[model samples]
Target: MARKLNDIKSDVDEKRFLFHQFFYKNIDADIEIFISHLEKLTKVFIFSGIIRDFFVFKNQKPFRDIDLIIEEDLVLEEIFPALDFKKNSFGGYKIKFKTVDIDLWVIKKTWALNQGQLKFKFDYLNALPKTTFFNFSSILFSLETKEFITGKDFLRFLRDKKIELVLKENPYPELCIVNSFYYSDKLQLDMGDKLKSYLKSNYTSKMNVESIQLKHFGKILYSDEYIRNKIEEMFTN
Candidate 1:
């Protein structure tokens, strides 16, 4: 059963336990072992989509990928000496396990934060939420502490099943626009006014469909016509 927002908000300990349980059960056994081993080296966090999916679908839906934030600066090769890892364009390391792919990076090297696109007065963990494009993708689960760190409106938006733009100024506005529609459709969530307006203003004929495809590793979810019609419907509605 999906957890109610009220119940989740009411009990932090239970929610933490549930999050850990969901993560351990759903993730591949080998990947779990990798994460456990990595945590011994540095503070690691499981962030964004997977965490949100846990709240929305629990163990019902399979996870697409895992995003990890490492608190300490360490050489990836030193830690995973035997495993093969590739560097992503955004300065993260990508490791593909048997069933799922993992993206790991130092918290300070987060694209938006590293480029100064997003600013925070507090630490990286606190600033992590502000780096996301959507409120639902802004929560993080600490692998070491067994706690959750959520952004503003994270719970409220999740409860409403609404997709709201949390960070408007992003390095990849086009990708963010594509993700807005992608997540909205995939999660069966409604788009908020801010996101609707942003999409309307930022979407253009020159938008690179090929680039979007490449970002998703050539996997096309929504067709060009489908995305165009969806944006057009946004304006009409």
Candidate 2:
């Protein structure tokens, strides 16, 4: 779904890029609304899938969830008295902001200590990029400021319009697997040869692609839509 800037010669592509840039600029406005509700939070950032879809992947589908992280944990009930928030099966709060849902996660402490998840200190800004599956997905925008941080190869990968799977110590392989499936088949994206090869070698066993699907297909995936829909359904109670 991402086209290299050099390859985008048509007016339509130019318009699309401008629209994306516009969204990026206005994203903090929505984020500010969330920040206003919270008390004394020194640092706040919304990262991962939302940033990737809006800026890097440039998918046609609207963003399903904005993954929020804060420097300190705040009780959701205190912030929004009018609405109910559902706790994700994972340790986080899932609450809708108007029509869009935001998955609020915490890294302020060592609290959500699950196996295969990355660990970070309270104000460790660089920790954002270290937790993502792909370099391009590692960008994060500050909810309180104009500053942002990106993965090491994020710029190069975007300029090249290549889909790459990061092999460096992945804390979330399950997320990576589900993401690759969604992007390649659901989004109708063409995978780079390296990405394809890595998926085959690491994900496939004994060349049995069908079996791989059989194991993962029906299981819960960590995609944005998956998280959003589940949270939406929970609020019906």
Candidate 3:
């Protein structure tokens, strides 16, 4: 019931699918609270892996958290003042309420991060990669539509895929190394030689070999194992 890259974009069909996933699992109590709060927000979207996990596959792990992106950072502070929220080194705010850790991310309009940059004009899609669904990061369920918007390469996970690296502005450093290793090990795909050099020269060079060894391959054994299983299921059967 999910939309593919080639599917016609229609609000009616999309509303139906969102409703389907809304009932696929008992909505996490905290997420239910978050959804109820959505009526008060403006230009907000839930751009997390969970939407894809529930809508496309319906085989995802039970609720751990949800990531929401809002147009205004100040409005969030005003809305959820009672909740404990902290801005992290990454461009996101961690809002904890009961069992839910809702990541409140602000969307700056500028696609590229640079000094003296004016916000309120950037597209969120530019930050995400054109890789497999595991790395296809912009699966946003906009509150305006009440449905998910698939990324440009969402269906490429079903094919022999190529990764395009426009990473000079990439904010998530972990993806450059951890995800590169993940795809190479599990999917028989290598980080294209250009990105390999870019990573080595820019980010990966600073780490000690042991640290790199542990983080690059270690996240799979720890938090990302389910992504591995889901990938296997999608690629195999």
Candidate 4:
């Protein structure tokens, strides 16, 4: 049976101490391993649900997937299999490797043409943007580094000044169509599992989400009108 949200919350609150105790042990060790591996790769950034959970949930639960973005297609094609990931085509822009219930995604460069792929071409050494909550700090591998980003940093990242907001237009229309199509048919499915499959089927169609892997298109193009219509259509069926 699906766990009730309140029941889960109450149980978690009571055993909060246990959660903290186990957290330091496994969390510290896992982060170390992730950091060590990340340092060895070239031009890589982390993304997707795992990134979402880390920043939003503070790594409280074990993350289900480890999504990565590599600049080189050769590295994605050659190295993933060696690392025990079962690679498969994902839509047109991403790849998936499943481990347990975790679904990792990898997006190659040129994944976002509409976002002026130029945004990605900055000199990593000279132009690495100042760290922000969602873009930089949450893209972390070390628990130590995680601690360095305080609540203040989060506020700075999320705070929007009405006059200064720089919102770029979304680039992927076809990807939106494909994702909407996938979710409509699979109401019970965890999107992580079928992400790549849905993507590969419509590879030629342009997708707007940026980043190298598990990039979320909804953030860019999912408007109020779009979501409301989708929901209404779902119930009507």
Against the true structure, whose TM-score is highest? 1
TM-score of each: 0.89, 0.60, 0.61, 0.37
What's the lDDT of the predicted structure labeled candidate 3? 0.51
- Candidate 3 local lDDT, 72-190, one digit each (tens): 54555677677687876646777776765777766652233322232323454444332222433535666665655555544433232444343344544555545555545544554
Give residue 5's error in model 4 in angstroms. 33
Give the alpha-carbon lDDT of every model: 0.80, 0.55, 0.51, 0.35
Across 10-80, the per-residue lDDT of candidate 4 in tens digits comes to: 44344434433443444445444543564476444444344334434456456444444433344433544
For model 4, the stretches where C-alpha displacement exceeds 4 angstroms are 1-38, 41-44, 71-77, 80-110, 113-121, 124-157, 160-237
Candidate 2 regions exceeding 4 Å error are 1-32, 56-62, 108-123, 167-175, 185-189, 192-194, 201-237
> 1-237 in candidate 1: lDDT tens per residue?
666766656654468987788789888778988988888889999888787776777655577888898988778887788877998777789888888888888998887788888666568788888878888877888888888887756876756679998878887777887788778877898999999989888888788755786777577776667777888998886
lDDT for model 1 comes to: 0.80
Per-residue lDDT for 40-83 in model 2, tens only? 55566766676556554554345666677776766667767766
Whose lDDT is greatest here? 1
Q: Residue 168 lDDT in model 3?
A: 44
Error of 4 at 101 (Å): 7.4
Between candidates 2 and 3, name the one with more favorable TM-score: 3
**After superposing candidate 1, which stretches have Cα over 4 Å from the reference?**
1-8, 11-13, 214-217
